[model samples]
Target: MKTRNLIYRYLAIISIALGANFANAQSFPDRPITLVVPNPPGGLVDTSARLLSEPLTRVIGQPIIVDNKPGASGNVAYQFVAKAKPDGYTLLISYSGYHVGNPSLMDKLPWDPVKDFSPVALLTVSTNVIAVHPSVPVNNLKELIAYAKANPGKLNYASQGNGSVSHIGTEIFKQNTGIDLVHVPYKGSGPAIQDVLAGQVQLFITTPPSVMQHVQSGKLKGLAVTGKSRHPGMPNVPTTAEAGLPSFQLESWVALYAPAGTPAPVIAKLTESVKKSLALPEVKERSDAAGVELRYLTPTAMDALLKKELPYWDKAIKSANIKLD
Candidate 1:
């Protein structure tokens, strides 16, 4: 009789807990939802968050707030969201560079990208552009590679920071092309682009948004885009393949994530809202203006992407001999 009573009590407690979780999921965002961004305002990640917030708010019937928590190459924000309550109230705006690259670059991380967070949505993807100072004496990708090869380490390349997509991508480019360019790391894209504009750095492979206007104004020469096709905003520039370096390609993406233990029902609700928001015409217009492609994947698909990219980045980082820790 005593053993039967104990088992009954345990099952009863579990039932009550499940009932409470279901109730919470039913009323998931009774209040507001905060989207925690890993980078400061105005970059691609923050831009992607703000772009979704307006439409997502209408779809979810709750206000969405964006919070910027930038530091430590995005580790600060990653750790913050990793520890947030799994109540579906706090979500992370994750960037691909930090999500996949950090695992390979750092010795240890406070959070596991795969284990500590549940994928909510895959948001946006943007390809990087290879731009050079006007004075570089090269007008096209072939000429640029030839010039770099002839001059060797005389060309200095500016990256967003150490372990950033720009840094690692450029290293990969160097390995593929056999050209030597010195690496100069900056805190973020703003400083890196500023120095590039002032001719303090001769080369920068960054997102089109950062260098589009400058390229248009003739301040920088856009030699090639590192993707399969040209960016709509810069239709005149050829892709790396078109520019004769088919193997050199790089892209950065942003995604949404909640704490690992967030209930499945709540995740389903959030995913539905995101799908609705991405279909909005205004969202598409704004994303185009911002130089990012609005690419949405279901939670399962996003998880699959994370799984596939993690080891790919690990191999790339190892090949590049990059270690941050």
Candidate 2:
């Protein structure tokens, strides 16, 4: 009789534990959710975060507030979300560069991009354009390569930061072209673009959205986009491959992540919400105007993408000898 009673008691405890977990998952996100943007205001990440707030709020029935905590190339926000109570209230809106590239460049990051965060969904991919100062006298990639070979380190290229998307893209371009062009890192895209226009830098690898206005005004010349296909918005501009640099291709993508300990059901729901938002016509239009290709990925697919990209960027960083420390 005692053994049977013991079994019943054990079963009762198991049932209670399961019930509590079910309750927690079912009642997940009962409060306002904070989407942390690990960049300063007025940047691509901040803009994307604001764009997502309304749609996500509507879908989740809770106000989704975007918080900008920019520093260490998105390490600040990553650490914040990683240590936040894993109750689904805090989230990290990470760019592919930070999730994939920083891990290889930064000496000691506070959070593990893969292990400390749960992949929720991919937001969008924003491609960059290779623009040079008007004085460079290079009409296309070949001319630029010729000029760089002759000038060598006289040709300096500015990027958003030391280990930014543009910096890495330029590095890859240099590796493929076998040219010697110096790299100049700025605080963010804003300053980099400003200096590039003022002729403080001879070349810039920047995103379309940030440079489209200047390119339109003829302040900066659009050389090539770092994508396989030309952007629809900038049909006149050729792709890196089309411009004669075959291996130069890169894009900045934003994705959602929660603390690793968050419940699977919570991740599923968040992923569904992001997917739904991306499917909306207005969301698609906004992303397109910003030169961002909107493609929502499931958590499983996001995990796969991170796994693939991490190693690729690691190799690139090592080959380029990039070290943030």
Candidate 3:
């Protein structure tokens, strides 16, 4: 009789817990939702967040705030979101460079990308563009390679940080082309681009949005874009293949994530809203204008992508011998 009574009480407790979770899911986003970005404003990650925030606010029926927390090569914001309450009010704007690339680059990360966060949706994908300062006498990729080879270590390349995609990608490019350029790692793209524009750093291989306007203004000469085809916003630039360097290609993606223990129902609702927001025409227009491709993936698909990318980045980092710690 005592065992039966204990079992009844246990079941009742579970029932109440589930009821509370369901109620929370139904009333999710009673307050504002914050999208914590790992990079400062004006970069691809932050731009992606802002691009989605407006439509997401309309769809989710609450204010969407973009909070920039830049430091330690995206570890600060990542760890911040990872430890936030799993009540679906705080989400992460995850970047592929920091997400897949960090595990291999750093000795230890404060949080696990897969374990500490729930995959919400994959937002945008962008390819890097190789931009040289106007002072560099490189018209295209072949010219840049030749110039770097002739003047080895004379040019400096700026990266978002030590283990960022720009750093690894530039290293790989050096290996492929047998050219040496000193690395100048900055805290974020804002500072890196500023130095590049000032001719303090001669080159930057980064996302198009970060340098496209400067290229258009002729302040920065775009050598090549690292994608299969040309970016619509920068149609004048040749692709890596077109510029005689097919082996050197780099792409990055951004996604949304909730804290690991967020309720599944809440995740489902957020995913639905994201899908709707991405489908909006204005969102598409803005994303194209910003040089980021709007590509949406469901939670399951995003998980699969993360699984596939982990080993790829691991190999790339190993090949480049990149270590941040």
lDDT of 1 at 239: 97
The lDDT leader among the candidates is 1
Span of ten consecutive residues with least summed lDDT in model 3: 316-325
TM-score of each: 0.93, 0.90, 0.85
Best by TM-score: 1
Per-residue lDDT of model 1, residues 111-136, tens digit only: 99899999999999999999999989
lDDT of 2: 0.85
After the best TM-score superposition of candidate 2, give how far the Cα of residue 196 lies from its true spot, in angstroms.
2.1
Report the C-alpha lDDT of model 3 over 41-156, residue by residue, as the tens digit. Answer: 88678989999999999999999999999988789999999999999999999999999988887777899978999999999999999999999987888999999999999999
Estimate, for each residue in 72-188, the C-alpha lDDT of model 2 and write its tens digit: 677888898999987778999888888898888877778898889998998877788989899989888789999999888998899877888888888988888889988889877
Kindly provide the TM-score of model 2 when superposed on the true structure, using C-alpha atoms: 0.90
lDDT score, candidate 2, position 148: 93
Q: Assess the local accuracy of residue 219 in candidate 2 as a C-alpha lDDT between 0 and 100.
A: 88
